[model samples]
Target: MSVTLAVNCYERTYRQVLAPGYFPAIEQMNARTFEQVIALINNVGDPREAQDRAAALVDCGEITGFEFVSDWVPAALQHWRLGHRHFRRRPYLLDYGLVMPLVSSSEYILGWDAETVLEEPADWVSPSLDLLGSDSRVLHASLNWPPARPQDAGVEGDAVARVGDFLLSWGFSDQVFLISRKNMLATDMKTFSPAAIARHAPHPYTFEFRMESYQRASRKVRATYEPVRYRTNLQIDGVLDRTGKSQYEGFRTEALHRVEYHITRQLPSRLGPRWARNASISQARGTKQG
Candidate 1:
């Protein structure tokens, strides 16, 4: 059976919360390579994109090519003028969702364009997706295209294009996002009595899980990350026979399954009881893309 991923599309942009001084520099850095921009953003004392944005003010007339942070850039704007802004851009999808049995078990692929692709049909999928490793997490990758830019061409394009191609080729988004629910036995579920249900003790402050066999495509990059999930589950309220484990298993199999994904996903959230009220967006359930 094809596994349905818990989440499908993912996207991101230069959010202000991720940076403040970014507004002004946006114009200057717009002239340099995106790599140079990212380098400056990574150099802040606090390592936050906000501080690194300070470098954006370095226009052409102010600084020369020699003053960049050890090959980070050509001082954004040169002394000559804004110099045609050469922004390095790649493909990116703004929205997508997934249908997974559980948040943690869900997996989705992210294909960032690489500097190049093999002359022969090699393991592009392996190279692009291995970033997720075995552990689940949302991946928004940036592929490298090269031969050093104009000199030579690289992978087909950005992560977005590759992902779109995969989707088109597969005719569906199932395999890319695989999902499986972890069965929890009713016997194992120690439910508090109805009397204490409303005010039950908090879910003791703690959550940890062990990961095994985590792997990426190449060069062994070891990293750990928790995956994204949704808070959707079919609520069942009825007495259980508990007479036999097999019967219980059968019951679970027959019951409907509730799906979940990220917060911005299709469904809706209460969010303090005052959001999206009186709006179609709030009342809708599971918005789908044609």
Candidate 2:
């Protein structure tokens, strides 16, 4: 299979939260995480040696290409200024992510966030791709479903079952999945329509769009899920200390708190009418809103 990995690298957006005065420290953290991901990609094989076998999917011919997608500097700045009001709140979600398969020549594409690193030698993508072999009914399959907070585990499971046809999770913790160009087109992944973007403004950048698309697709297709191989460590963006729980975890927690406290509580008002600024206000409450 001609498989490609499309990674969404939003370095500019990573540092967008830092005001001009906070550039020195914030830039360093951003650069560090960026370099760390690059290094992880390089060291994917070295740590385990793969028993002298092909270590990376790249080496084994499972993933034939790597496309690093990001917005241009001008566009990034405008989007930052425009915030979440213009098109989609998280433009990178659709711009750098969902659009990958549509633009690629490869038959299969593994969409991933830059923060997600590969630590295992298993050909996760190829196996998932093989599972869908010649089965046009299978629309997409999740590569991993990382655990959510212990307390909310039950709620999460219920939500997954509720939307089993169109899976949803607490954002990034469960988004990694493998998809085909055919499925992408079938789900209308190319153009993120303005009306749809407005309706999903609150959680625009997450997998909700894809899930909804799948749900809306022909009823004959099926979606599959798999246990996560790992939680996939996060690169703490702006913290200097790496001795304990990641700063990324801290950042993610805070963001989720605000989402729960602000967005969820006020979804009616937050996503009121046609992409209101109230939602923008909720989205811009302190810590980075990636």
Candidate 3:
């Protein structure tokens, strides 16, 4: 059965409080108390006033404990920590606050074109892609690795190609971009240990790929292709290490790896003149390319 809650409550509690920068903590409460708290927060006009009221409930034993939400923490750090926990076990109820929206929106795209899905551990690709249904097409997939691979020639290309071939077997004609650093430097590592060497290396490149699927020429070919345009950003960036030494002392940085696949589907043929014109243009291009 699908979980259902009041829309306003979900937005205020989950989306607002649990959003990046805020850490939401709630004490144990029964259904009635939970609803009351939600109502109280909803009635308040100022964010700080709402927080203060919620804290008051804790002091009165109406709620056991609660933390006023604050945006002091970085979203990347929270996502990274949550990612570690997600891999260890099933996602917690709070984690659903983030996952549900992602899954829901991807499932909702019926027309108009363009959708992006980001996965942390490459393992999420299959399950997330499975939810896209048959109408959407994956344009590209990227895999990132720390600069710890053996210095063998063509290893990166070979690894990426193997993954590309695997995706092809899954009926996707998507391309794969592999990003990894080369020529490791001694200064990049804190120790000579294998684990440290592997963990501390930075990414070598950043790239973005966009793919568009156009209608086919013949009726037979048209049945196989969808009118959609997709754009994907697969890149790496330097992230500040919050636990590292202060700025005055010299801050530490780490690589933030991301894999995003975007899917865009065109409107049905009967939608409007605009779609009809675009489809015709796309078909001509497809025929010429073919």
| Each model's Cα RMSD | 23.4, 14.3, 19.9
Ranking by lDDT: 2, 3, 1
Better of 1 and 3 by lDDT: 3
What is the C-alpha lDDT profile of model 1 across 156-233, one tens digit per residue? 211111223231010111112211222100011122121111111111100100000010111111121112111211
**Native-referenced Cα lDDT, model 2:** 0.38
Winning model by TM-score: 2
- Model 2 segments beyond 4 Å from truth? 12-86, 154-174, 189-202, 205-211, 216-228, 233-290
Best by lDDT: 2
Q: Which of 1 and 2 is ahead in lDDT?
A: 2
Residues 237-279, candidate 3: write the lDDT tens digits: 2211222333432322232111111101133433321222122
Residue-level lDDT tens digits of model 2 in 63-109: 33333333232353343343333334344444444345444676775
In order, the Cα lDDT scores of the candidates are 0.21, 0.38, 0.23
TM-score ranking from best candidate downward? 2, 3, 1
- TM match of model 3 to true structure: 0.19
Count of steric clashes across candidates, in order: 14, 0, 1
